[model samples]
Target: MVEQLSRREGDCFLLTPNRSMSWKGNIRIWLAAFILSMLISTGMLLVGAWPVLPFAGLELTALAAGFYYTSRKCQKREVLTFSQELIRLEKGLTHKEKEWELPRQYTRVWQDVPRHPWTPPKLHLQFRGEEISLAPFLNIDDTEELVAILEKKGLRVEKRRRPEKLWF
Candidate 1:
């Protein structure tokens, strides 16, 4: 999701991934799967297959962990505030884990075109020879929208084509 926040300080852009399922919906789905798996595992236990119970528990645990990680990832975001001469970036999941303030004139926006058509292009902010990826979870359209916003703000965008060679 790309949202523009109205701010007196500067133009603010909030970048977050779009998640189709709400937490409540996710919980309900996981609960249903849990109940079904437990019922089958318990039925196996009664049939003298005790090992199925532990394995079921392990499988459910793994499923719960994956769900939790995905939920947390959805909470991640990047807030970019472009002032007249400076750019502020606040990135985190729920809280500001990383914040950067750099001179807008010196910062350059970079877009890397991937060789494969299935893969989405990458966007990054280059400052002082170091590059920071910008909203990696954004899809192709949203990525292009971000680039448009950056260009509108007068940030120079450099496009790069990724190499096609596969090397270990």
Candidate 2:
């Protein structure tokens, strides 16, 4: 998820990951799904199909595991702030966070594309031989959009080479 927090005259760019669903909503949905599954499992048990009860329990476990993993991933986020004087990148969740700051004049934006077509490109900020990756989860289109935003913010954007096409 990508969102433009604010776009003002002085404020160059503010990029933040979009949170589509709230944690409360996720909990509600998970509870509803769990209850429905339990109801189905009870019906199967009443019908003399004892084997279905164990399978249903396994299904519930899998569903709970899936929800747990998804919620954890959703908690991670990246925030990029670019202004005239400073360029900042903040990543990770609340408990564990990493931040980097560089002068806007010396920072250069570029995309590192993989040789394989299947792999997604990564947006990077390079300054004085140090490189920091910006948006690793974004797709090709979102990466391009971010580059455009950076360019608009007066940062030097290195043009990426077009990938070679393979014909079967």
Candidate 3:
């Protein structure tokens, strides 16, 4: 479950990426590999084929590693705080915080970019001749929601349309 919760003071938005057990995503891939590995392992055991045991074990290990990495990388939490002059974002695993002071009358834009279902949405920040990224672990809808919240705080969003038929 992914959610954007506001702080008690309403000065910030806390984005938390909750643990998801829904096998709708990469779990399917891992399960398939695990099943295949189990089948091979069983076949090897039944036929007295000891060499195949290592191969099956290695395949199962690979699948477990993949699942662990994917789950960890997908989890995230970000806190977007707004002040009268600047917007601060605390993001990443370390929750390393960064701040961007708004200009006196700046243009805010939301660019419509193409995104894959498995990939997280990217936040592009431009201020004081510097470009930084915030909320690098959010999905597209969450990105758009954050953008809208920022717009209410008086920032411009520039968006580019995503082309149709993304797959080549």
Candidate 4:
């Protein structure tokens, strides 16, 4: 089913549920991420000797920021839509929302699906004239479907020469 929804507080559109994606996969990965973040944060707290507290505090804060950003990014249940001139995506937590903009002329969309049951598909979009990837959380199918739709709408999509490493 093709459903279109307006982004809550933006002049953007969201297209979703061409088919329901596997939330089990998304959940497992998020669980792993939470555990990994906790483990690293705890390890830093325990082993970082002399400057321990302060350093650990910083590390924990960074982790919190990362988690907050990630959760905020994932809160929405929609994939964004755009035309050839502009692209916008909505993400963030319950009350605080964030949006990102990419001029279509300066962005490239890349799609990759790894071989892991819990690994959701990812779409890596690079902006800054290909120097930085602005957003990279979109799952594989979402990426492909969105790309196809956008391509049909005449947006430029490019294939990456190499896979972009997603380190979150």
Highest TM-score model number: 1
lDDT of 3 by residue, 16-121 (tens): 6555654356678777877887887888889998788888888778877877776776656667666665566666655564545544255244454656556555
TM-score of 1: 0.91
lDDT of 4 by residue, 1-168 (tens): 224566543334453333233446546665676666666667776776545556555665676576555554555443354644777655443442655677877667664545565665455666875443323455555556666765765566665344566877
Runs in model 3 deviating more than 4 A are 1-10, 16-19, 22-43, 94-112, 115-122, 160-168
Model 3 lowest lDDT segment of ten: 102-111
Model 4, stretches more than 4 Å misplaced?
6-12, 15-74, 77-84, 113-120, 129-141, 161-168
Number of colliding residue pairs in each model = 0, 0, 15, 5
Looking at model 2, which ten-residue stretch has the lowest summed lDDT? 8-17
Q: Local distance difference test, per candidate?
A: 0.90, 0.75, 0.65, 0.55
TM-score for each predicted model, relative to the true structure: 0.91, 0.74, 0.66, 0.43
Q: Which residue pairs collide, candidate 2? A: none
List CA RMSD, all candidates: 1.6, 4.5, 5.3, 10.5
RMSD, model 3, all Cα superposed?
Answer: 5.3
Arrange candidates, best lDDT first: 1, 2, 3, 4
